[model samples]
Each structure stands twice: as C-alpha cells, then as structure tokens.
Target: MLKLGWFSTGRDQAARDLLKVVWQRIKEGFISAQISYVFLSREPGESKESDLFLKLCQELGLKIYTLSAKNFEPGLRQNNREAWRAAYHQKVYEMIKHEPVDLIVLAGYMWVVSAELCQKLPMINLHPALPGGPQGTWQEVIWQLLQEEANETGVMMHLVTPELDQGPAVTFCRFPIKGGEFDPLWQNFKEKMRQIGLEKIKEQEGEKEPLFALIRKEGVKRELPLIVYTIKAFAEKEISLINHKLFDNKGNLLLEPYDLTERIEKHLKTGEW
Candidate 1:
C-alpha cells in the first residue's frame, strides 16, 4: 500500500468534504492506500471553518500536525516573503521528515511550495484545468475558459514544482463544455452577455452565472474521483515517481499525464470506478 501524506489549509467546507470522501474511500477499499499523516497550516481557533475541519480529523483518528504559518516568524514574513516561504517550508520539512510517505497530496494548500521542498518531497496537487488548458486558481481558470469560448477543459493531478501550477501532470480527464447540458447554458450566457457585457456579468453574477455554475459543478463532481483514482494508480504501482518524474509500471516515462476520462465517466454513470 502507498503511504499518503496530506496537506491542506482546511480553510473551507470543500476541504473537510474532500478528506471525508477520501477517508471513506480508503475504508471501503476503493483506494489501495492509507493516509499516513495530515499536515495543516493552521492551528486551533485559526478560523471556525478550520476548527470544524480539525474536529472531523480528530473524530476520524487521523494523525495531524499543525504549524501556524500565521504566527511563525512575523518579522521575516513581513519583510521578505520569498525568504519567509523558504524558511517556512524548511521548518515544515523538519517537522515531517521523520515520517516517510510515498506521496504527498496537496489539497487546499494555499501557499506556494519552495524549490528546495519540491526537490525533497514527492508531491502532487490537483489543478482544476486540463494538463495544458489554463493556469490559475480554479475560479480564474473557469473565468478564462468562458472568456476563451473554450469547448473543453479538465482537472489534473500534477507534480508540484516551485513554479506554481506549471508542473507536469500525472493524470488528467477532460470533458467538453459545448454539448448536452452545456448547450442551453451557453446559449443563456450568450444572451446575458448581449444584455449586459461580460464584464458586467462578471461584476454582478460571478460564479452564479448559469454557464459558469455548470462548469464548476461538472468539474467539482470529478475532483474527488480524480484524486482518489490517482492515489489508486500510485498505490497499485501503475504509476511510479522516480526523481520527481512519473513512469509507468513497465519503466517507460510518462510523456503526458495518463487520461482517466473513461474511468471517471464510468464511475459517474454506473457508480463503478
């Protein structure tokens, strides 16, 4: 079984829900791995959201370690963000160095990792865009997709590098934004765009825009599956991490992130992964 390390800021409901789902999957033997440690960047009482997340973790009996990035070395963090990031990650490394994990999963981890830390850890983050679709926060990515009139997008599990979101993907699944459910939504969006400019729609409607909401909904449905199945792939040795590069079980380098659309869609359709 692959030993997984989890990192998260525990900032919101999505954070807690993801942990619950992944833990449930593990218990159900859906993913052939166990989470070894969960590292949070916030401490108790950091926020009500995170506090609830902590309570759930305790209830689940998952080992958790928290270090307050909020309170750590205030002077350096104020004066020099780059140095602070490096120093902060170094301390984080020191704390978890003893407990070895085969892969570290970044879930809702807000901070950018340092180059030094990237080299030391086998880490992957779920980016809410296809392998080459867009690069930014999920909201930003969605906005860009709409602006581009893009017909397709996806989510991917990517190797975490010092450069934010530029990392090569391990696995990804794409879906079209133009057919079936999306058609009516896009038509409504075009009408709204004509009624009030795209900027106005963004300023007022934001994520609540019909097309945007559906896009996010479609993408969110896939995230938990994308992550768990990626973990499954790792646990079963279908994929391997060597010197931060991904390789198939047969020892061939993966030039691209393996596609999981068929598997994800199957689960979405028949509830079988």
Candidate 2:
C-alpha cells in the first residue's frame, strides 16, 4: 500500500473537506493508499479539530504522530532565528527520517515547511487560488479576488517548493462567480449580520462575508471531484516532478490554468462543465 504522511493545522473547513475527499476516494478504490502518520503544528491540547482527525485515523487503523511548534519556542524563534530554524528543521528531519513515508501532503499547514524538509521528500499542497494568481494567505487570496471583481477563481494541488505557493501545478479546477446572481446571497448574509448587530461584524470584518459563504458553497460542490482526479493521477503514476515542475504522463506540462469570465459565461450558457 502507498504510505503517506499528513501535515495540517486543523484550523479550517477546507482542510477538513480535503481530508473527507481523500477518505471517500480511498473507500471507493480511487486511491489504494494508507495514511501512516499525521504531523500537526498546533499543540495537542489546542485543537479540537486535530482531536477529531486523530479519531478518524484511529478508525481507519492508521498510526498517528504529532510535533508541536511550542516545543521549539523562544530560543529558536525569538532569541535566535537561524539557530531556532535549524533546530526545528532537525526535529522534522528526524521525524520523516524515522517514519515509513512515501509522500508528504500539507493540508492547511499554517507554518511554511522549511527548505530542509522540502528537500527530504516529495511534498504537495492545496492552495485556494490557481497557480500564478495573487500571492498571499488563502483568505487574502479570496479577498483580493472579490475586491478585484474577479468573475472566476480556482483551487490547485501543486508540488510544494521553498517559495510559498509558487510551486508547479498538478491539477486545477475552476468555478464561476456570477456577480449579479451572488447579490442575493450577499444581501442575505449582510442582513443576518445586521440582525446579529453591526458591532459583531465590525469586530469580525475579515471573517464575515457573503462572498466567502458562496465560495464555500462552491467549494463543497467541487472539492471532491478535484481531489479524486488529482489523487487518481498520482496513484496511477501519471504525474512527475522534474526540476520542481509538474508534467503529465507524456512528459508535457500539465497546464490546467483557469479562465474566470469565460467559465462564468459558459456556465451561464450551459450550466455545465
């Protein structure tokens, strides 16, 4: 069986949704892999989501392991940056070195994986935006897209590299955001916020959004298919990483770039992919 290790922060629904897709695919025979271990950045006591994930892994009969960022505290972080980083890297290296892992997958891991860790194994990450789009945290990516009046956006599973989200693409799936159609959802969310009191919204401006609610709706719709497709490709040995670039079975770049307005127009026209 294919052996895999999962790295995540367990802070968001996206990561949970992704894990659900993986589990579903495994059940359906799309992926014949076993999760060997899980490495979390959060302290064991701090994450309820982490607890839930651990329970799921137990049900699946997978071995679970954890490393806490708190262990590498002030000495490595504030007192001396490089020394701290080096010590932290050694800890991660030791974990992977001793574990039986074939691939490393990052699911909403908040901290950047050190370069030393990246060089030790094949790694992949799921980012909120398509490759080559705006560079920021996932929330920032969504906010920027909305602010720019973008009609389309997407998610990508890409090879992880040292430079943030600048890794080569693997599989990308796009969806449309019809500005006019989403107005009702936006208005509804706004009114709900108003009823809840504007002060609550004021304190949570970045977190409150009609657009995000809509995007999340779309994510639930698309996430399964995308994860299945990507994992299937990987399981079949149909994807490769050469010089940090992703290539299809034929050695050509897998360029599944997304077009925003065009996708919206097509959906408006046919209501289908």
Candidate 3:
C-alpha cells in the first residue's frame, strides 16, 4: 500500500471536502492507497473543521496527529529561525517516521512549509489558480483576476515549494468566464460575498461566535473531487517531475505553458481547444 500523509489547516470547506473526496475515491476503487495519518496545524478546539476532520479520521480508522502553532511558539522562538522551523517540522516528521508515507499532500495548509520539510518528503499542493496565475491567497487570486478583467481562470495541482504557489505543475483544468455571460460567475461571487457579509453582521450583533465552519462545509462539496483526481494521478504514477517540468505518464506536459483562457473560451463555444 502507498502510505500517505494529509496536511491541512482545517480552516476551509475545501480542505475537508478534499479529504472526503479522496476517501470516497478510495472506497470506490479510484485510488488504491492508504491514508496513513492526517496532520493538522491547529487543534480541534480551534475550528469545527478540525474537529470534524478528526472525527472522520477516527471513523475511517486513520490515525490523527496535530501540532499547534500557538503551542509551539515562544518555544519555537527559543531557537534560531532555521532551527525553529526545523523543530516545528520535526513534530510532523516524527508522526510519519514510523509509518511509510510515500507522499504528503497539502490541501489547505496556510503556512509556507520550511525547505527542510520539503526536502524530507515528496509533497504536492493544490492552488486555486493556474500555475503562475497569481501570487496571493486564493481569495486574492480571484479578486486580482477580476480586477484584470481576465476571461478565464483555472485550478492547478503542483509540487509545493517554499515560495507560495510557485510549484511545478501536475495537472490543470480551466473554465471560461464569458465576458458577456458573467451572470453565473458574478452570482457565485456575490453569494459568497453576501454570506460573508451576513456572517460579519451576525458576529457584530453577537448572535453567535465567529465560526469558520461554513467555509469547510463548502470545501467538502466543491473542492473534494479535484483533490481526489490529483491524488489518483499521483498514486498511479501518472505524474512525473523532470528537469523542473511536470509531465503526465505519456511524457506530455500536464499544464500547457501558455495561458489558455482564450483557448478555453473557444472550446466552450466550439467544443474543442
């Protein structure tokens, strides 16, 4: 069995959803590997997503481990910057040391991992934009594209590096945002904004404590499938990194080098790129 370790902050619905999809895929025979353990940056008390993820892991018979940044700090600061990072990574590395983790997948991990950690294992991350798409958080990536009037955008699974979202590509799938037919996209964006705005209003009104639970719920619904597909490709040896280039099993580039917005739009209209 290919042993795997999952890393996520458990702050977003996508993170939870991604794991669920992977779990489902494994159950359905789309993936043939064992999720040896899950490592989380935050403890369950901090976020309901973390709580639920732990519960799911328990139900699935996977081991669970956590390293709280809050707890690690100060002690983490006792060492030099490099040493601190190493110490923190050691927490994660120790859990998988006894297990046979072939790959580490970052779903919604917020921190930029230390170079020491990357060098220690084969890891990959899924970004909410195309490779070299934008250098910001997922929300920022979308907002920046909107500001630039980009007509298309995509998601990519890539090798994780210290630099955010600068990883070598694994696979990318894109969709078009027709300039005139922007209603669907706009509606989606507006709905998200409205939901956030309402949540803020509620928090200010003191109806309930601030919660990130909704985001995690959405992740499980929308982002799970993509994560599963990416992992399936990896487990089946459908992905390869060669000379800093990522290739599919047949040696074709998984992500085309050029921006494919126009091509994608054309494909949407004519059914071919």
Candidate 4:
C-alpha cells in the first residue's frame, strides 16, 4: 500500500475538507493507501482556524504531528529568511523522518519548502492551472488567464521541486472556460475591459467578476477529485515516479499530463457548467 505523508498549514476550511474527503475515500476502499502522518505547521492555540484543523485530525484518529512555524527564530526569520526557511524545514524533516512515508502530498501547505528538503523527499502539489499555464496563487492564475483570454484552464498535480508550481505534471484534468454559460460573461468581460481596462475592472470587482467566479467554480469542483484520483493511481501502481519522472506501470514514459479528465468528470458531482 502507498503510505502517504500529508503536509498542510491547516489555515482554512479547505484543509479540513480535503483531509475529510481523502480519509473518506480511503475508508470506502477507493484508495489502497494509508496516511502515515499528518504533519501540520501550526499547533494548538496558534490560530483558531488551525486549532480547528488539528481538532479534525484528532477526531479522525490520524497520526497528527506539528511544528509551530508561526514565530520560529523571529529575528532570523526577518533578517535571513533563506537560513530560517532551511533551518525550519530541517526540523520539520526531523519531526517526520521516522514515519516511513512513501509519498508526500502538499494539500494546502502554505510554505515554500527548501531545496534541501525537496531533494530528500518525493512530494506532489495541486496546481490550479494546467501545465505551462499561469503561475502563482489561484487568484493570480485566474486573473492572468482572464487577461490572456484563455479558453481552457485545468487542474494538475505535479512533482514538487524547489521552484514553486514549476514542476512537471503527473496527472491533470482540463475543462473549457468558454462556450455554454461562459460566452455571455466573456462578452461582458471584453466589453468592460475595453471600457476601463483589466486593472480598473479588477479594482471595481475582483474575484466576484462573473467570468472569474465561473472559472473558479468549475475549477474548484474538479480539484478534490483530481487529488483523490491521483492518490488512487499511486496506490494501484497505475502511475509511479521514477527518477522524478512520471511513468506508467508498463514502464511507458508519460511525456504529458496523464489525462484524467474523463475519469474526474465521471466522478464529479452532477452539475452544468
């Protein structure tokens, strides 16, 4: 069975929901794996949100570990950030080294992992955009996509390298942001951009813009299924990473994102986009 090492800052309800969903899938025999440990970056009393996340882990009976990163080496964190980041992750490494994790999943983990630690372990993260697409937080990605008039955007799980969100994709699911319900919205966006430009529209209505909201809604619906099915592939040995490159069970090199669009959409909750 694939042994999972879960890493998350537990900063939001998404963290709690992701853990719940994965654990539910594991219980339903959809994934042939066990989560060996859930390593959090904050402990109790740090923040009400993270405390709730910690509580959820305990409630689910998963092995919970924490290393409070809130104010570690305050002066050093402010002065020499790289040094602090490395030292911080070194301790994080020490905390979970003995658990015998087969893979690490960055599920909403909010820290930039040090290169040293990236080399020491195999990790994968969920990126909101497709491979070779926009880079940055989900909001930035969406804004850039809107600005680019991108018709298609997708979700991907990629190997975690030192560079944030730049690693090669392992699995992905793509969906169109145009056609259907989006046509009128895109028309409006184009008209508005011509009137006041992208920045001005953003200032007026940021994420709430219809096109942006619709894009995010569709993307968010796919995110959980993508993560679950990716784990399922690892558990079934249908996919594996060899020398940091993705390959199938037959030793076939996967040069592109292993397209899971059909599979993910099949499992997605019924809705029209």
Candidate 5:
C-alpha cells in the first residue's frame, strides 16, 4: 500500500470537502493506500475553518500533525520572509522525519515550499489549468485564459518544485471553453470588454463575468474528481516519478497530460464519488 503524506492549510470549505471525498474513497476501497500523516500549516485557533478541519481529521482517526505558520512567520532575522519560510519548512521536516511517506500531496497548502524541501520529497499539487497552460492562482488562470481567448482549459496534478506551478504534469483532465454552451457568453464578454476595457470590467464586475463564471463552474466541478483520479493513478502505479520525471507503470515517459475526459464525464453524470 502507498503511504501517503497529506499537506493542507485547510483554509476553506473546499479544502475540507476534498479531505472528506478522498477519505471516503479510501474507506470505500477505491484507493489502495493509507494516509500516513496529515501535515497542517496552521494550528488550532488560527481560524474556525482550520480548527474544524483538524477536528474532522481527529474524528477519522488519522494521525494529525500541525505547525503553525502564523506563529513561525514572526521572529525572522532581517525580516526576510523567504528565510523564515525555509526555516518553517525545516521545522515541518523535523516533525515528519521518521514517517515513511511514499508521496506527499499538497491539497490546499498556501505556502510556497522551499526548493530544498521540494528536492527531499516527491510532492504533487493541484493546479487549475492544463499542462503548459496559464500559471498562477485559479483566478489568474481563468482571467488569462479569457484574455487569450482560449478554447480549452483543464485541471492537472503536477510535481511540486521550487517554481510555483511549472512542474511536469502527472495527470490531467481537459474540457473546452469555447463554442457550444460558451459561445454566446464568450462573444458577449469580448464585446463588452472591448467596449469598456478589461480593467473597468474587472473593477465593476470582478469574477462575475458570464464567461468567467461558466468556465469556473466547469473547472470547479472537475477539481475534486481529478484529484481523486490522480491519487488513484499513483496508488495503482499507473503514474510514477522516476528521477523527478513522470512516467507510466511501463516506464514510458509521460509527455502529455493523461486525458481523463471519459472517466470524469461518467463520474459527473453518474454522481459517483
């Protein structure tokens, strides 16, 4: 069985929901693995959400370990945030040094991991874009896709490196954002933005643009499913990282995102977890 290390900040409902869904799948025998430990960046009382998340982990009987990023952020010499972050990651390293974790999954960890730590662990992260697509937060990705008039977007699980979101993808699912259901909305958004400029539209409407909203809805629906599928792939040995490069069980290098459209569509249609 794969010994998994779970890393999350547990900052929102989505983070909590992800843990629930993944744990449910594990309990249902869908994932051939056990979570060895859950490493949280925040301690109890940092926020109600994180506290509740910790509570849920305790209820599930999973080993829960925590290091408060808030408590560590202060007391950095020279006010060097990067230096402080690296030290904090070092502390995290000490906390889990003895655990036998095969892979680490960053579910909702908000901090940028240090390069040294990235080298020490095989980690994967959820990014709300396809392989070789826009880079940044999901909101930035959506906005960039719209500005570029992209026809497709996707969700991917990629290796975590010093770079924020540039690592090679392990698995992904793509969907079209143009034509069909999106044609009218895209057309209107383009025309409106051309008339009023993107800055003005953003100031006035924020993320409520029809096209943006629809695309986000489409992508959001696939996020958890993709994460689950990615974990399943890892647990089943369908995907592996050999020398920091992704490969299949046959040792074939994966040059493109593993297209999971059909499986995800089935799950979405069947309401399967």
Candidate 6:
C-alpha cells in the first residue's frame, strides 16, 4: 500500500472538510493507500477547527504528530525567520524520521516550507490555478484574471517545490470563464470599477467583490473533486514521484499536466463518488 503523510493546518472548515473527504474515500476503497500519519501545525487549544480535525483523526485511529508554528514564531525576529524555519523543519524531520512515508500531501498547510524540507519530502499541493496560469493565491489569481479579461481558469495538483505555485503539475482541470455565464458579470464588474475607481476597491475588501465572489464560487465547486481525482491518480500509480521527480508509471518524465476536464465534467454529471 502507498504510505501517505497528511499535513494540514486545519485553519478553517474547508480544511477540515478536505481531510474528511479524503478519509472517506480511503475508507470506501476508492484510493488504494493508507494515511500513515497526520501532522498539524497547530496544537490542541490553538484553534477550534484544528482541534476538531484532531478529534476526527483520533476517532479514525490515524497516528498524529504536531509541531506548532504558533509556539515557534514568537522567538524569531524578522531577520532570523528563515533560520528559525529551517530549525523548525529539522525538528519535524526528526519527528517523522522512522515512519515509512512515501508521499506528503499538503491539504491546507498555510506555512511556506523551507527549501531543505522541500528537498527531503516528496510532496504535492493543491493549487487554485491551472498549469501555467497565475502564480499566487486564489484571490490574486482571480483579480489578475479579471484584470486581463481572461476566458479560462482552472485548478491543479502540482509538485511542491521551494518556488510557490510554480511546480510541475501532475493533473489539472480547466473550464471556461467567458461567454454567457460570465460576460454579464464581467461587464458589471468593469462598469462598477469605471464608476467607483480601482482605488476604492483596494480600500475595500477585494475578495468580497462581486466578480471575485462569483469566480471563487465556481472554482471552489471544482476544488474538492479535483483534489480527490488527483490523489486517486497517485494512488493508482498513473502519476508518481520517482527520485523526487514526477513521472508516469512507465518512467517517462511528465513534461505536461494530465488533463482531467472531461472526466471531472462526467463525474459531476453523474453525481457519483
């Protein structure tokens, strides 16, 4: 069986939900693997969401380890943050040194891991944009797309490198964000900005903007299923990491992402797991 190590901050309900979904899939035999252990960046009483997540893991009999970032942050000033992080990751490396961990999945880990840790772990992360698309958070990506008046957007699972959001994709799904479904909103957004000025938007909550909200909703609808599908691909060995590099089962290096748009659409239509 594939030995998976799950890492998540469990900062919000969505984080917990993602873990639950994966656990359920594993239980249903949808993924032929075992989550050997779970690592959290928060300790008990640090956050209710993480506490709840830990409670669930306990019920499921999964091994749990924690190295609290909150506990470690206070000792470091800005200049020493990088060095502190390296030591932090070293402690984590020690914690899991004996586990037979094959892969590390960053479900909702909020911290930027050190390059040293990235070198040590075979990790994959769920990014909110497609391969070769925007290079920041979902909010930044949506804003950039709107500014460019782009017609397409997507989500992907990519190898986690020291560079943020620039990793090689394993699997991805794209969808059109144009035409009838989008033009009305796009027009309204442009008109609103024209009347109110972009400065006002910068002052206000950008994520709550009507255009951003609509786009995020559409993207979120795909996030859960995309994560599940991508992990399924890894579990079945259609995609894998060999010597810390991504490749197909045949050992050919994956130069491009595997597209899953049609399969995702079909699965959405059937409403089956």
Each prediction's RMSD to truth: 1.5, 5.2, 7.1, 2.2, 1.8, 1.6
- Model 1, 99-189: lDDT tens digits are 9999999988888888899889999998899988889889999999998999999999999998889988999999999999899988888
Deviation in Å, model 6, residue 45 alpha carbon? 0.8
Which rank order by lDDT, best down to worst? 1, 4, 5, 6, 2, 3
- Cα RMSD (Å) between model 4 and the true structure? 2.2
Reference-based TM-score, model 5: 0.93
The digit string of per-residue lDDT tens for model 6 on 74-176 reads 6772558788878888888889878867789888888778888888888889888888999777778898888888888998888888887777888899888
Higher-TM-score candidate among 2 and 3?
Answer: 2
Clash pairs, candidate 3, are 12-216, 13-215, 13-216, 13-219, 14-219, 17-220
TM-scores for candidates 1 onward, in order: 0.95, 0.78, 0.73, 0.94, 0.93, 0.94
- Between candidates 5 and 6, name the one with more favorable TM-score: 6
lDDT winner between 1 and 6, please give it.
1
State the lDDT of candidate 5 residue by residue for 1-273, as single tens digits: 878899999998888888888888998999988888899999989999999999989988889899998888587924987898789899999899899787899988888898878888889999999999999888899999989999899988899988889888878888999889899998899898889988887888878988889998999899899989988988898888766778888889887768787789899999985
**Residue 159 miss distance in model 2 (angstroms):** 1.2
Question: Which candidate gets the maximum lDDT versus the true structure?
Answer: 1
Clashes of 6: 0
Candidates 1 and 6, the one with greater TM-score: 1
Backbone clash numbers for all candidates listed: 0, 1, 6, 0, 0, 0
Give the alpha carbon lDDT tens digit for every residue of 83-190 in model 4.
998999999999888887778999889888888888788899988999889989899999999989998999999999888789889999999999999999999999
Q: Give the TM-score comparing model 2 with the true structure, all chains together.
A: 0.78
Better of 1 and 4 by lDDT: 1
Off by over 4 Å in 4: 269-273
How well does candidate 6 score on lDDT at residue 13? 81
Off by over 4 Å in 6: none
> Which regions in candidate 1 have their CA more than 4 angstroms from the true location?
none
